[model samples]
Target: MVIKPKSLLKNKALNKWNLFWLISGPISIFMIINLLAVDTSTGAGISEMIQFSVRWAVPFVYLVIATSSVQILFPGPFSRWLMRNRKYIGLCFAVAMAWQALFIFIMSYFFHEYYYSDVYYFRDEIEGSIGYIFLPAMVLTSFNFGSKLLTPKQWKLLHTSGIYFLWAYPFSVYWWNLYYYENPVLIDYVFYWVGFVAFALRIVAWGKQRYELSKRIDPNYKTPIESKMLGGLFIIFGLLVSASGLYWQDLITSLFTCFSMVRRT
Candidate 1:
């Protein structure tokens, strides 16, 4: 009798573990390369390495937060997949951000003389520090056991506020760079807009849910189809924006460079 091989991807119980490895494995490899292969002889190289890590990881962070909103906006196989795997996606995001934080710590503390210039100090003092405070709180509460410590309302408030705070980091960074430094990278714009769209989607969904709840108390209240239509429009707009961003040569080059750097190292 022929026996079928067990597939790790098909195992639902191990979904979180699979996500952990999927996200962490590449990040770990990149960190190793930065430590070993990247020429950190100059402070500029170290700064570039740090920026590289942040840019690559920010998309995944946005994606994790977008999962719920995306599911609400587009109810289908893709949306269902996102909803089913949201917990793992969120955990993976925390892991990715933790990796980014480690790189920042090393840069600030160990290579302070080389990397911690005036700009770095100013940025960290103003924004990075605030962002870091929320990171640990969100990460800790991401697990089921940790979440149980807080009332459902408390948990919702913390995560909702935490994600908004974290979202500000990339938005502020890219906007500041775009306006002040004149570095018009397509990917940065994509990240900023995607973050905005995700937040907007959530707000709309929440408002609609509340309206629906209130309608239950009234006999004449009717559910509107406009919400679904609006959701569909949002999903379509998101896909179009993402596709346009992916077509940019500069963004493609940057992604390839990042991957090649890791591969070569």
Candidate 2:
């Protein structure tokens, strides 16, 4: 039997609406499981469950933010598919985040004693609130009707800054944990660096596009080879950082599994 080519295997005809539900259905199911499985009897359990929900939501948020950057870096079938379905992906992220917010509200209602007293709440009031402020605006403008109300420049400004704001919340959280926590999780460190790389790539892409536009306006202006060199340097640095992060992640996972087994035995 002949193996199918990757190009042939790629689903170029995916409907965005169907794609949205396909991605969101599993997430909704996962949230349901978290809601059922979390021990809601204690404040600690509620805190753990809230973290679980937020952790699960983070990847989708990162994907929605990184979708355009990824497409810019690698133009291919997968990237094209991502570009086409990005709005749906953002919607999925919004749904997940909204559920996470609901869990937070429930925690505040039931475990007000701890929730109000915790330093986490105070920190969240600053960092998390700012991030949440962008969510509703971004989500509302994501639809055609809402987008139509804004000029093209206004829409672009809203989303460009909104994505960065959303990106910063998780990045800052993970970066802080990596620095201040005695024992930071490998995944958190990985995510922090991954967000950094994504942001860097986005800047590089934007700069390149802007430079091209400038060149078009001023034909006499020489293309800046130095800027290209800097971008190449950044890509190299990013790849090295990503490689090390993944390596450490695997090493830590293996050690943790071994330690768990030893404890069980």
Candidate 3:
């Protein structure tokens, strides 16, 4: 098949998004479980169940739809169809973020102390840390204040550092939970391993992109076939990660549900 440039770029974007979910989705699930199942309930147990279910289920469903829409609207085989629906995709992401913020507030205050205690722990650790400070920095830069107040280099630095911190938060939470509970579960190990793998791949990708730029800086430079080879390797890796993440998500959810059931009974 003749691969058009646009098609290739589109595929690359989808692959990136796929890898992103692989890294991010599991953390989302873990948070959802902690927010709903392990968290204390008030009113009727059924009411707690309903609230928890909505908070957990709806966000993921919206995430799937939004990310898929991003894949479709931005590029890939379905770009044309996706372009027509791009507004909906953006709206979905906005809605998802809103839902996420709501949970953050609920999980921070309304529930048992353990949930917010974790948040405060992170806040304390993250406030003074070097590379870790970027997560908040990036969120700041993404808004108008950073754009207007910070220099270009400062903004770039904030975003670059922020990306790594955002990725690290999930695994950090898992490890903290494990240490606190004194039980190292499979999911803990999975989070650490998969999160590191994802982070490593990201660093590698950044390096490769830099190498490509350096090569291009030379007047005689021609793009190497090795670039395509690297891309192909990443594509394969992306698929595997996506599949593994989905499988683990189901497994984790089931385990958490079982534990929650046992707790009540």
Candidate 4:
């Protein structure tokens, strides 16, 4: 007699709110522990916690960005699972960002000079304020109550714009860290590539999608992998050059440091 192993992908209870809690509960615990380990009595401590929360929050947003692409590129049980839980995953990001918001408020109120001088930049403030605005707007519109107010096209535009903006922020952050920053952390490399690859997958999937659409439009129209292969080559060459930046730091520092993120460093 053979005993079949249980497949988690088939489990209905594992998605939705259950999935949200399962992922978020441990994240919250670690976040609290991180808070305790820090000296939160000072502005710097609160600031550090804010960065920590961002690290915690970003992975969920990555999942949100890539899940649909994952389904498009490689449809399977795991991809389906990711697709089903996308909304809940988004909720997890909102909750984590809420934590950062709390810390931001604490720092701005109690450590005004530190928050403004050390943490705030007018350009970054504008970017982040736009993000904050999109955040709650996306959250509210995720549900039926808020969603019903918008037309389907409007709703789709809101989410698509918000997710891409959200993806761009972190991807740019890590890209700057990897390409321009001094003493970039190991996690900086990890997050940069992970974000890079996730978006890359979406690009590949889009190419494949357009290829398929073209064929459907004209069955006799022949298509070659030239575009796809060329696209892949560009990605490879770009990665090699970008990865080579570490050994040639002097070139970038002189050229790009003055242009450093308006207060992002």
Q: Which candidate number would show the highest TM-score if scored against the true structure?
A: 4
Off by over 4 Å in 4: 1-6, 224-233, 244-265
Q: How would you encode candidate 3's per-residue C-alpha lDDT over 60-138 as one tens digit per residue?
A: 3223223333443344655443444333333333333444556545555575364544334556445325433443454
Q: Candidate 2 at 158: error in angstroms?
A: 1.5
Q: lDDT per residue, candidate 4, 1-265, as tens digits? A: 6533337655656789888898788878988999999998888999999989999988888889999999999988789888888999999999899888898889989999998888897977788888899999999999999999999999999999999999888877887787677788988988888887788778878877987898899987666679668877898887886678666767766668767764576
Q: What is the TM-score of each candidate against the true structure?
A: 0.70, 0.77, 0.39, 0.87
Instruction: At residue 76, give the lDDT of candidate 3.
Output: 61
For candidate 3, the per-residue lDDT at 90 reads 30
TM-score of 4: 0.87
Look at candidate 4 and give me any clashing residue pairs: none
Kindly provide the TM-score of model 2 when superposed on the true structure, using C-alpha atoms.
Answer: 0.77
For candidate 1, the TM-score is 0.70
Better by TM-score, candidate 2 or 1: 2
TM-score of 3: 0.39
Residue lDDT tens for model 2, 1-265? 7645545425443448777787778888988887788778877777876777677677777887777877877878777777878888788888778877887877788888878776355667787887788888888998888999899999999998988888888887886677545688888877887777767767767776787788899978776798778878977886775546534655776899999999999
lDDT of each: 0.70, 0.77, 0.50, 0.86
Better of 2 and 4 by TM-score: 4
Distance from true location, Cα of 264 in model 1, Å: 53
